[model samples]
Target: MKILVTGGAGFIGSAVVRHIIKNTQDEVVNVDKLTYAGNLESLVEVSDNVRYAFEHADICDKEAMERIFAEHKPDAVMHLAAESHVDRSITGPAAFIETNIVGTYVLLEAARAYWSGLNEAEKSSFRFHHISTDEVYGDLPHPDEHPASAELPLFTEKTAYAPSSPYSASKASSDHLVRAWLRTYGFPTIVTNCSNNYGPFHFPEKLIPLVILNALDGKALPIYGKGDQIRDWLYVEDHARALYTVMTKGKPGETYNIG
Candidate 1:
């Protein structure tokens, strides 16, 4: 299968690209706009693979998305592109709104147009998987603040959307768009919401990486008040594997929570 992965140079996206290139016989076309969050250096290991390709493009560009879809003729598309930093979004939400909300809209339309012209077999097999965050469900009371065994306050698939930050709100909008396309146009779209991820290539804006780097550099670890936030996290490689499973074996129009 030939998969087109948007934001394929970013942390989690790079892991997905490397996983497919190193482990599977399937091909990957990486589309990224080379934002500060994205680093092509992370993909160096798989850059030379026969089944890997790269396209420097933004998801917000309709023409570029359409052209990419036409050129790659991919069997699937995994959308991981977005302005994902909460602090950045709070300081400047325009980028988040543009890339996460408007960008998703453009990509969906472009993908719909491409899918409309596919042969029966290709259309039936095609999938558009939107990668999202658990943050859209919003925050729960910090588990550390609660009693050790007081049910652990978790957000399940049935949780209501209450995005507290611009970042989460934009992602929530994109998730809604994907589902709307699935219902209104019968687009073969799937969605996945995942917990925070950490592993190799994680940029330092994230707490874990920031603390690790600061500690290694002999600086004090920066911890927020009381240092008691209990955030769920998963390894990047594990997340990559789960994404591939959902893309390959998941049913269309279904949503999965991965961690």
Candidate 2:
């Protein structure tokens, strides 16, 4: 199958692209806006591959999205384009709202329109998978806040959303839109909310990479929110594998928690 992956130049998105190109026979159409966080260098390994195609475009641009869908004729879409930094969102949220929420809406409509024109067999098999973050579940109780004997509060797939940051809130909104499209329009959509990811090719803006780069420069490692907040971390390649599994085998109108 040909999969059109938005944000395919970003960290995790690039990892997904590499995984698909190197591990599978499927073709990939990489659609990225080349935002501040997007670096084409991450995808250099797969750029020369015959099955890999790259499209430079913003997800929020309706005409660009429609053109990409028409040109690529992808069988599936893995939507991952967004402004993801919480600190950046706190300082400037307009980009987050535009890319995360509005971009998702635009992509959804574009993909839906393309899918609607497909034959019955094609429509039945097409998939639109939206990738989201676990942060939408909001803050969990700190380890110190709970006694050792008490079970630590963990977020499940069914956890209620209570987004704390502008970034998370925007993601939460996009998640809602995916579900609504599935319910209201019978779009073949699936959502996966995953934890923080860290691995090779990660941009320096992320905590682990920032710390690593700063430590190399003899600078003190930075910490946020009392340095006591707990979070889950997943390897980027592992996350890519899980995403491919979901895109190929996952059912529509279903949500999964991935880590």
Candidate 3:
């Protein structure tokens, strides 16, 4: 299959691209805007592969999305483009809203149009896999906030939306748009909410990479709010594999949680 992956130059997206190019017989069209967090160097390993193709375009550009769909005729789409940093979102939310919410809507419309033109067999085999974050479920109870004997809850597929930050709120909005497309238009869509991811090629802006870089430079590490907040960290490679599984085997109109 030829899959188009948005944000394919970003950490997790690059991992997914490399996974497909190196491990599968599938072809990949990497559509990324090359934002500060997106480093094409992360994809160096697979960039030279015949199965890998790259397009530098913003997801919010409807014309660009339409052109891409028409040119690539992708069998599946792994949507991952977005403004993802909480700190950045707190200071400037417009980019988050524009990229995460509006961008998703544009991509969905483009995919719907392309699918509408496909043959019945091709349409039935196509998938639009929406990648999301666990933050949309809002903050979980920290150990400091509850007794040791008390049961702690994990974010599940059925978790209710309660986003606390602008970034999460934008992602939550996109998630809603994806489901609405499925229910209202019979779009072949799947959503997956994943926990924190840490591994190779992670941008230095993120916590794990920042801490490692700072420690290497003999600088002090910064922690948020006494360092008591908890997170479930999933390796980037594992997250990539899980996404591929969902893209290929998951049921449309279904949601999966990966950690």
Candidate number with greatest lDDT: 3
RMSD of 3: 0.9
1-259 per-residue lDDT for model 2 (tens digits): 9999999999999999999999999999999999888999998888999999999999999999999999999999999888989999999999999999999999999999999999999999999999999999998887887899988888998999999999999999999999999999999999999999999888887899899899999999899868877778999999999999999999999999997
Per-residue lDDT tens digits for candidate 3, residues 71-169, read 999999999988989999999999999999999999999999999999999999999999999999998887777888878878888989999999999
For candidate 2, the 10 contiguous residues with the lowest summed lDDT are 223-232
Q: Estimate TM-scores for all models.
A: 0.97, 0.98, 0.98
lDDT against the true structure, per candidate, is 0.94, 0.94, 0.95
Clashes of each: 0, 0, 0
**Alpha-carbon shift of residue 66 in model 1 (angstroms):** 0.9
Q: Which residue ranges in model 2 land beyond 4 Å of their true spot?
A: none
Runs of candidate 3 exceeding 4 Å displacement: none
Give a tens-digit lDDT track for model 1, residues 1-259: 9999999999999999999999999999999999999999999999999899999999999999999999889899999999989999999999999999999999999999999999999998999999999999988886657898678777877899999999999999999999999999999999999999999999987999899889899999888888877788999999999999999999999999996
Candidate 1 clashing pairs, residues 3+ apart or interchain: none
lDDT of 1: 0.94
